[model samples]
Target: MLSLDYSKLLILAVVIAIVLFWPPKNKSFHRRGIDPGFLNLKVWPARIWFLLRGRNIVEQAYLQEKDAPYLLQSLNEDSLVLPPKYLPELRMLPGGKLSASEALVTSVLGQHSGVDVVLKDRQHYDIARVQLMRSLPTLVPILSAKVDSILSETLAACSTADFTHVKIKEIVSALVLRTTLLTFVGPELCENTELQWLVEEFTNIVRDMAIFLLFIPKFLRPVLWPVLPPTARMKRLHERVRRILFPKTEKNVKSSRDFPTVIDHFVATSEIVDEKEIVAKFLVLMAGALHTTKMSTSHAIIDLCASPECVDELRNEALAENLNDLPWHLDQVSCLKKLDSFLKESQRFNPPNYLSFDRIATSTFTLQDGTAIPKGTFISMAAGPMAMDPGYYEDAQTFSATRFCKTDESAVESGAEKSQWAHEFVSTESGNIHWGHGRFTCPGRWYASAVMKVVIAQILRKYEVKFPEGQRERLPNVYLDLIVEPNPKQVVRFRARE
Candidate 1:
């Protein structure tokens, strides 16, 4: 009976896949056209090819069609790949027309997975944009202190006269989550080990659910969600998170603290004060903040370990600035030009994702060049390829640690201020879209940058890090469809600096 039921479901799924994967009979490509490769095949085969070689496919298309818009069929949807030239116009389009949030919802199957906070309410993001940015001046010092304390404890616990192997991702993830939670909840609540475990588990659960649901047809999600193991785990985790966070959120809503947190701001500003709503918002914010920052920091450390020659250079810069002797000021952090450039270079080589400026057209629109974008068409820029394109950066294939800072050298010689010479890691320029571009560019970038700088600088000042013996290069990055991640098991040897 069970086998028979499974067979029926499998047959039903294939039928749905066949219908969904059927190519449009009258595919239109306004002025600029669909990639020739995609035009010749049924959309399913093209999507399969994409899953196999999406990065290379994107790079090839970008190199081949540098000037014009082209269409590429991806799993789940077709995206109109636009050149950077269209960025200015696209940025100006109102959210109702070109909706990044809606694009995210489609990308993640958010409606089925309960990750639609952006579409349901913009208040959390607005609070992050305004209050979070407003609080950074005060927040930086607090974060710096927290980072220093955490690193000191980490190093002490792992101390050995000789080098000791430590998983870099584990260290970085713990540090990123703790600091993120400190900023979100408060110092006291951030220290709850159970709460921390739940948040991490919850992030993993949601990510797995999203991936599982991605292959399921949209119409079938409602039917299948109840029996999905991840869904059950998600429900239990959500309840656990609410139980842990509700009392604190309820308390915060009534009275503000001296040092305002992201939760406090969300409660104080948002009209919706329901405990479940606040907890959901917190989970969304924590997941975003924890994942990207953790990956970037881990990659930066691995990059540093691989480029041993640059280690002393960065260490000297950190020591020269007395970064460890005092709480970090934003301006002081900015002045670490060499470190900043190295970080930017690392990220250029290992971005969080291959695409950026992702949006879905809510209504049909025409480009200045007469290319038409039909309503419901998904769109993205080939950000990963563009970052390495020779047209954008000279010797783009090589990792030049000082590529961004070399201009600063001339500025310094001309007596320009350090601020003038400093290149920010959070730049969303066309040439560097590691952070998504436009009005919807990452809101917490400034905070992420500050935290990363502090954590890396502390490591350089207090410890020596290198890849395990015989590992001469950084571990190759793991790629999942469009997303990129530093290898979670990558290990580095660490010893306290004498």
Candidate 2:
């Protein structure tokens, strides 16, 4: 085994050397537009710069290029950074022409990461877009109750007089994961600590492996995959996940439970009957919903803590709506306009990703402006930069908790012709592309928004939370490549309200 490992390492080193020294082929399509300065560097070095300062590169490119598309080279792939102006035309293209799933697979090295299920079968996406969404009215109250219960039990040690320290990310992650699992699986299995451990472990291993593999050229992944340590661990965890989920999936298919779940919907709607296939579908769903919601919720909490005035306003809004009451309806929740605006602003400042509307061209296509998107080219919008663009928003860099709510309030007071839901957190307008845009916009966004609102409302009503002493501002987000996440290590103090 030792000898085999040594030989694998030697081969890896040779591959690395070749990748570093090789001159990358310049795409003719990239020649059509201005090259982001970093793209002029050698392949490995360019990717290194991107990995280190991707956000800056993207923001600078967006500022320089403005309405035109520009080329950006990253660790794993090269993407055309399309401006928000092109969203109207690009969103209308059929999936066969511009494939989001293909882009997702490429971004994550899904084939080798054991999540090729996203590429192979889109049953999970369909369930999310249709069944899961259609069932939100029924799911919201259940999730709200679950969130309240989890927070109550988790924060039981806190008192009205003194604050108890907690890692906000961990607390929010546990809450989101358990509640998400409750909707994906059943209540009993959702609480299974062993299964929870396996799922979280599998996700972390896959994420770490994906990021590491992204640094390697695409062609070399297959060659080096077998010897990668995380790959082996992922396989073991996958097998354990299958063992735990297979029986549950089979039982779910055969019986009807009181509260139907995402698994139930999968079993009913999908032609896939194989237990392993079902497990893969479930894993994909969990991966999509769990981390994004957790991070968004955590960021909102951090943002709330940083702005005490907003907390009081949001708490007042929640109280006015009686948010603590059980069996809250969607209509009732929607009335918390101030809370919704605060969440939207929080997301605008700290989106889950710096880029959005990522797609890969299936066939060569030219835009109306004569810019050609060659086949296999990856594309994305500079969503983070767009949020801060002063053209779209006034005082864009400053965070106003009522930024979006003011529009709604004005519309009501003036009786204007604006849609009430225009600026809500889940809105996917070109200006607000965090949830994505057009037909393929996130189907589960409404669910995610409701979950966030419920969690925040509960925290606002039941507890007083703030940054630890001497920390006055929100912690800076931790950026990894294009991914942006709330600082996981940031601590907050929570005390039960009198």
Q: List the global CA lDDT of all models.
A: 0.78, 0.79
Measured against the true structure, the TM-scores of the candidates, in listed sequence, are 0.86, 0.88
Where does the lowest 10-residue lDDT sum fall in candidate 1? Answer: 30-39
Please give the range of 10 consecutive residues that has the lowest summed lDDT in model 2.
409-418
> Model 2, 1-498: lDDT tens per residue?
999999999999987776556544544433222233333335566677778878887887778767777677766677878888788888888888898888887887778876778777678888888888788778888887888889878888989999999999779988999999888887778888988997788778877888778666557888998888898888787788777766644453425345688877877876757777777768767888987898899999999889998888888888888844665667767888888888988998998899888888999998888877889989998989987877666677789888776654332223222466765778755566788787768878888888888899888888999999999997778998888988877999999998
TM-score of 1: 0.86
Query: For residue 199, what is the lDDT in candidate 2?
Result: 76
Stretches of candidate 1 exceeding 4 Å from the true structure:
1-26, 29-47, 157-160, 248-258, 408-422
Clashes found in each candidate (C-alpha, N, C closer than 3 A) = 0, 0
Model 1: per-residue lDDT, tens digit, 1-498?
999999999998987776666555326642222332323345556667778888887787788776667667666567777887787778778777888778977876676666787677788678767888888778778888898888877766556578878888778877999999889888877889988998888777777887787666657889998788898897888888887767544464424444788888877876767777777778877888888899899999999988998988888998888744788777778778888888889998998889877889999988777878889988888888878877667778888787777763432223222354346687655577677766768877878888899899888888889899999987778888888898877999989877
